[model samples]
Target: MKTILTAATLIATLAVSGAAVAQDFVQSGTTPTLPQREGQAIYNAVCSGCHMADGRGAEGAGAYPPLANSDFVESPDAVIAWVLNGYRAMPPLGSIMDDEQVAEVVNYVRHNLGNSYEGSSTAADVQAMRE
Candidate 1:
């Protein structure tokens, strides 16, 4: 009986914690936003899952394609389009992220990752592309 009671208490505690976490994610009933808005912050939270923390991509069953010193990252528009529209294996992040976020990530990839590209993209550019 003591063991059963302990198990039940643990389950109840977990349930309450989970509910609190879920509530934190909710904002005015609309879709929740990312924790940070900075370019690097967004990259670390979202892009690094596949592209890796160092910006060097991975390959296993499928290739993630390296972003380090790649000519592809030179063009801000191209990177933005791919991120918003989705590529071969990557899913589109258009709906998940706002225009500013798309631009920030694009700019982050362009300037960092061993690729020194000229000029940074603006939110306006992303919005124009979306339209």
Candidate 2:
């Protein structure tokens, strides 16, 4: 009787552990894919001149700011707005890029240099901000 009870308890513990592991696997597997892999090209064409390839801006003595360690990239909505509307010295990109392209570039910046914050920006978000 004692052995049977111990075996049942052990089995229950194992089952709980297995379920926890499965949940972790599912969560990690659900990360969304980035929209663009040609992030380098997009950056070069649009952003590199100002922000630089390393995401460090070149305005003046610590004036332009660097996106490499920026907190702005962590928030999808904030980055989207800044990209579309422009910041202090940054020009608005909305005129140049459509919603889809904006999203792709946003994803590129976020994943490639934005500390891998793992959030995706949508076209709807951009349009709404414009309105």
Give the alpha carbon lDDT tens digit for every residue of 47-131 in model 1: 7656766778865435788888898788888899998999888998787778898999899999998988999999999999999
lDDT string, candidate 2, 19-130, tens digits = 6444432322333332223556556556755576678665432365667867768888888888889987778877666677677778778887656877677778778888
Give the alpha-carbon lDDT of every model.
0.78, 0.67
Which regions of candidate 1 fall more than 4 Å away from where they truly are? 1-32
Give candidate 2 misplaced runs (Cα > 4 Å). 1-38, 59-62
lDDT of 2 at 40: 60
Q: What is the lDDT of residue 65 in candidate 2?
A: 66
